[model samples]
Target chain A: MRFRVFVSLKPTVLDPQGQTICRALNGMGHNSITDVRQGKYFDISLAEGVAREQAMREIEQIAQDVLANPVIEEYQVELLEE
Target chain B: MRFRVFVSLKPTVLDPQGQTICRALNGMGHNSITDVRQGKYFDISLAEGVAREQAMREIEQIAQDVLANPVIEEYQVELLEE
Candidate 1:
């Protein structure tokens, strides 16, 4: 099975990279772009035979403990159908 | 209007960050995780009054020219419904 994880800076956290991208876009004349926030996306392929529920639990734990910085980031996980 | 852009390393490109994360996860006992690929996600909010088609075209251009390095990365853009 495959899983997708999205890890992003918390709304309250300042994202300098995102700001830089926004500025670059504006400089390129893409003025209609008002805001740009950047984050991380992970595509994980799990080995076969793991139960769905267990896999989900493990993924959630991984997202919280390894994939995201709890102090400044947030994460979401979703199972993808092959 | 809002757009979501996903930028990922090309399959042929090596991703050290992702590899490090995978190793870390395995060391942490998530052995079921077979493969991990990392990418970037952008949540962009565009100013109002822009036609959807125009916004999409602008976004595609931005994704290709600014959001991603075409030499090593590929990007996908999608409109988000609020």
Candidate 2:
């Protein structure tokens, strides 16, 4: 099984790195961009024979416990088709 | 207008950070995880009155020229509905 995990900062949090990117883009003349928030993602592959239900359960747990810092970040998981 | 941009290393590129994360997870007892590839994403908000076509054009350029290191990374852009 494979999953895509996206981890982003809570909307309320400040994102300096994203701001820097925005500034760089504007400087490059792509001024239409007003704001940018950067985040992390993971493409995860599991061992074969893992059941879908169990894969979902474990992937969610991995996302919540290992991939994200729940205090300021939120994560979403998407199971991929074979 | 808003867009989501995902940037990931080319499949052939080495991803040490993702490997470290995988090792950590395995060491922490989540042994089912076989591999992990990490990437970056951007949530971009554009100024009002920017047409969808232009937003798409400009966001793609920004992603291609600035957000991703095209030599080793690839990026995808998705227009988002408010």
Candidate 3:
């Protein structure tokens, strides 16, 4: 199975990096780029036969405990077809 | 249409962040975590009726001109069905 994990700052969090990018974009005349949000991506190719449910459960745990700070971050998990 | 762009360091590049994570993972006993890589993700929602090819070409330009350091980074683009 393949999984793609996106971990991003919550909307309420102050994103200095994103702000910088937004300012740069506006300066570059891409005024339509109203907002910029920065995030991390993890692409994992797991061993075959790993059940989807088990993978989800483990990934959820990783997201909550290791990949993100629950107070300021949110995560999305996608199970991709192999 | 929606698009997801992934910008990652080339395998030949020295990834200090990934090295640190690898060491940390090893310390945490995830010995199977032989390698670690870090990357950035951009999720973009475009205006309706945009042609996929146009969007892809624009994104490729952005990836090459703005989001990625062609010398050390590589990118992948995926058009997500809305």
Candidate 4:
């Protein structure tokens, strides 16, 4: 099975990369773009035989522990049907 | 209105950063993790008054022309209700 995870900075957190991109876009005349926040996306494939519940738990742990900065970022996980 | 965009490399393309993370995870004893692919996520806020359809079209164009490498990556855009 495959799971998709998105890790994003919290709304209160500053995103300099996102700001830089937004500025670049504005410079290019994309005035309609008001704000931009950047994040990370991950596609994870799990080996067979792992129970769904176990996978979810493990994924949550992996997401929090390895993929995202707990103090500044949040993560969402979704199982993808294959 | 807000939109979320995810840009990912096509499966045919190799992802070294993802591989490096996967290797690190495996080294940390997360053996159930089979494969990992990494990508970019963007949260875009569009200024008020742009029609949904126009926003969608402009977002598609921006995604293709600026946010992603069309030759190697694909992107998905979703509108988020505020």
Highest DockQ model number: 1
The whole-model lDDT of each prediction reads: 0.91, 0.91, 0.71, 0.91
**Model 1 lDDT per residue over A1-82, tens place:** 8999999999999999999989988998999989999999899889999999999999999998888999999999988854
lDDT of 4 by residue, B1-82 (tens): 8999999999999999999988888899889998999999888998999889988998888999999998999999998864
Instruction: Give RMSD (Å) of candidate 2 vs. truth.
Output: 1.2
Q: Is the docking of candidate 1 incorrect, acceptable, medium or high quality?
A: high
Residue range B9-80, candidate 2, lDDT tens digits: 999999999999999989999899999999999999999998888788888888888889999999999988
Worst 10 residues of 3 chain A by lDDT: A29-38
Scored against the true structure, residue B80 in model 4 reaches a CA lDDT of 84
Candidate 3 colliding pairs: none
Residue A35 deviation, candidate 2, in Å? 0.7
lDDT of residue A78 for candidate 3: 79
Question: For candidate 3, lDDT tens digit of each residue in A1-82?
Answer: 6666789998889888877876776687554444556789765445566667876776566567776788989988877555
Clashes of each: 0, 0, 0, 0
TM-score, prediction 3: 0.74
Best by TM-score: 1
Candidate 3 lDDT by residue in tens digits, B3-79: 67789999899988867865775686544344556789776555566677876776677667888889999988877
Enumerate the chain B TM-scores of all models: 0.94, 0.95, 0.90, 0.95
Instruction: Estimate the TM-score of every prediction.
Output: 0.95, 0.94, 0.74, 0.94
**Every candidate's TM-score, chain A alone:** 0.95, 0.94, 0.88, 0.94
Off by over 4 Å in 3: A1-3, A44-56, A79-82, B45-53, B80-82
Candidate 3 residue B33 Cα shift, in angstroms, is: 2.6
Each model's DockQ score: 0.91, 0.89, 0.35, 0.89
Better of 3 and 4 by lDDT: 4
Candidate 2 global CA lDDT score: 0.91
Q: Retained native contacts per candidate, as fractions?
A: 0.93, 0.94, 0.25, 0.90
